[model samples]
Target: MAWVKWDQILLPYDYGGLNVSSLKLKNYSLLTKWWWRFLTNDNALWVRVIKSIYGQSGGLGCNSPLPATKMKIFSGRNWSQIINIDQTPSKLGCNLSNVFVKDVGSGLDTSFWNDIWIGDLPLKDAYSRLFRLEVFKDATISDRITITFDSPVFSWAWESQPTWRTEDELASLTNIIKLHKFSNNSKASWTWKHNSNGAFTTDSLMQVLTSLTAAKLPPSSATDLSPFVPKKVGIFIWRAKKNRLPVRVKLDRKGLDLHSTRCPVCDDDIETLHHSLISCKFASNIWDKVRRWWKFNQLHLTNLSDIASCSNPKLVTTLGVSIWQAVVWVTSYYLWIHRNNCTFGKNIDSAAKIFSDIQGKCFEWINCRWRKGALDWLSWITNPCRFDSIFTKNGIG
Candidate 1:
């Protein structure tokens, strides 16, 4: 049975792949949805069930026995102070400690100091001294009196006078208070701040969780391959880079067919992903012509890693990096297809012809998929290094 890597399978469709959804990631998103419902729909059955279990610690901690036990044992323990790797507390638990509020419509449901409503940050954390001196720490949004529209001002009632050391906190509070505008008609609710829409999303959750995995991964140089390149092309590049392509030699090693596992284009050596994509004489000829055409004479050609390194935006101008990465991808795609055609089909295109085709495909991909300035085919073919100039001429960059 063929199985795609979880990361590749979940890539966006435009990146030369299927638009399959990961249930695990979807379930994580649903957990946030449940939280949203539990916080906003106070009378719902599930909400009642949750409140019965978790109780109201006001974003301090849950009422679960495990957390309760951990809190009792590790109370006042700063996470940074824990030197033991095995005993380090999980970050997933920490995410629950901060509750972001969406103060829309009537802002009565949210607590001003305790909840992270303002700019997705807590007022207490931002203004600790002022928070400590506040008369009503748990004051609801409605408790902050709004004056007349002609003279809009918040009448804040503090428990103690501001001290000399609290000047910075007072300044920050003044700036934050001015920017507190409510979104009309929408209900006041709590949402995960990780998502832009104030809702949970699998993509965002996966990014966060993948970052926290215990095992460290090798540093990756691959560009943002999806959403720019076609899915078929992107998937092909991904498999080839991983050395998992269905080459005859690889199939033979896996106890499949045992005959004729030689290079299809060159007929010189064993046909592996590297030989077919880069090392073979046929592929090298195409790469040579492409380098000269692009005027990148000093560019190195060795493996998929080299190609990936070239795709780094930091190495080249940001405006042209996407198109440059696409060019490398399109070249790899053409080489693979040419090898397949020669191996399985009756006809195969020459290296020069394949290079020409790659150039055309690159132009089409950049123009069609590009959301920035419109690309000119003549300009691209003439000098791709000047691709950014087109955007400058049109005032579009």
Candidate 2:
């Protein structure tokens, strides 16, 4: 009799003819037919299940769908009251079955449920809908249930399971983690290694060392001694002479007296290399005119070092070096030319005219070859007013 009642609860409303109530229930077939028609007619399938399970427990009276609430219960707490609160059977059944089936699949038979569930919320879907209403309700009350039944229940309803990564793939991930770790620890050294091929062989390294050492010294006493010597010595030799200096006295195994060598520029003093290059009175006048053209006040310059270190603004540093070499070459060249001119009775330009000619040639070379582009040449040559007008007319304003 109890089994019959259980079967009555398990069976769909349309399938049964056995009378367990013994009340001689009339219109049973008609009622069953109508029940099926009502349950499956227009509502979502879960609503139909809810109606069937708890229809007699005032469940049908609630107009609204049950309010769903989620709460995470700690391991040791009573899960039933923590997760579900309604005294209503419909809400109670849904909440309980959902929680229990999820727990069973996740807790006991993980592999079984993992293989089967293939859609969203598969474990919850299986427990909620796979069984007949009576069996589902009974399972909610059951204390011992295997994950095998749960897997099939969830799988038959088609729910997605969580994916697990393989151990080998996880092992491969450690290489990237190690690379990031190395980057954080050795960033500066690694950057330098990449830039210099693990060797500091460039001029910039010397510059860096100079800057570090210079920081500890007074500005006036600090000097950068890194050599700027060019590979071609001929360029330096050519620029040392003005036109071409004559070889008058070749130095043999004989040492000449100071009085024997007379100044080529002025016959006043002994003409050693240093006196001819730097200390001559005639060369001083030429240098004074050149300095005036460059807008520096006349300072007594008695040596090559003074010319090398002079900070005249008009002499562009690079051009200054080139000009210095040119001056040295031209002076020797002019001295040779002057001697030949004097011996053969040929016309020679004065020292002032020669200096002016050097300046003109230097300007011509700068404008034509050394300047970067036509615009730069124009800017270099044009007056300020004309240059500004050209820029404004060209829409570069």
Candidate 3:
């Protein structure tokens, strides 16, 4: 049957000028003659030969694996020299025969084999399974041609697969230690706790002492001693550790003065860092106007430590913290300026005026420096009548 089909596909393309009878009468019989004809024919000959063997129904004959085996032997020799060889139709024809042999040898039922041979499998399932098998995962199709070539499958799987590493590639991973002798004549000063004969034992104290010696600041005629002498070291330490409290209480005290060790806005007793910042009556009023202008409630900032240690520290990049810090700094600067005005110039500005100045200055700074995004501060402060004009002028909305 196969010989009859091969004759029909190859008889018209023979170039030997010999009649079919003479060709058949040669040492090669019909099949061998047809095989010789198929190989020696033009490029179109392979397509016709494959069609004749497999037929329009796309079913490989029981003996189709033989040609596939021959093709595989031919492919293996110059394997590396072939580029896009798998994308040729002849390669696919060869693969079809190999697939059939694999399926039959694996003991798939005859019915299942018939379905696959005739291309009757569900399209999605066929494609997925073909992809899952490394054999067809990297197959490529060009025009009407389909090709499957073997890749470096399992050995280089690490390069093919995705993964993450815990440590950086740049780690040096080494260790070293050493010791050195000490000298009493060394000029290094000492921390009182580590000194035996006025030389430092700890690394930090030794560093400080060495720096002081290098600067020539120890008992030297060139160094000024007036600034170095101190009367209230213990008192300053006690004030730093124990005297601080919230700003609001200090703001509400009687007769509070900036120079009298009390909050000027509030005459609270024992005025401290926290009391001077958030709790002062002047600060509270300023924060209130700021919150209203920004359409946010005043942040309950209790102490300077809260401002300093906030996890999301204030930066020009931060929207809310940046705005808040701007307000705080401007308000502090204005209050100090007002204090100077009161003491030296004998001029006083109302808290409302101070708050207004802070808002105006903050908006000016933000508008000048922050050039991206439509932040809430912009809309909240810009006059409604001039909002569109400002946006158009600045090329922003």
| Per-residue lDDT of candidate 2, residues 86-172 (tens digit) | 232222132211211111223232222211112223222333332222222222201222234222112122233222432343233
Q: Assess candidate 1 and give its lDDT.
A: 0.62
1-397 in candidate 1: lDDT tens per residue?
4635565555444332344555655555445444455566777775565445434321232222235554455444432121111121134332543443555456576667766666545677778888888898788666774534623356677887788878677877767666666655536655666777777554676555444431233333333464457978776776666666888788888788655989878889998888988899988888888777777755565777766545542235555666677888888888888887887876777767788898888777777776756777776777777755545335334
- Residues 122-240, candidate 3, lDDT per residue (tens digit)? 21244333223223322211111211231111111122332222112101100000111122221221122223543222332323323332343212112111111121221222222
Q: Count the backbone clashes (under 3 Å) in each candidate.
A: 5, 16, 9
* C-alpha TM-scores of all predictions: 0.53, 0.29, 0.30
User: How many clashes in candidate 2?
Assistant: 16
Best by lDDT: 1
Clashes of 3: 9
- What does the lDDT read for residue 125 in candidate 2? 31
| Candidate order, lDDT descending | 1, 3, 2
Error at 167, model 2, angstroms = 54
The residue ranges of model 2 lying beyond 4 angstroms of the native Cα positions read: 1-259, 308-310, 313-347, 373-397
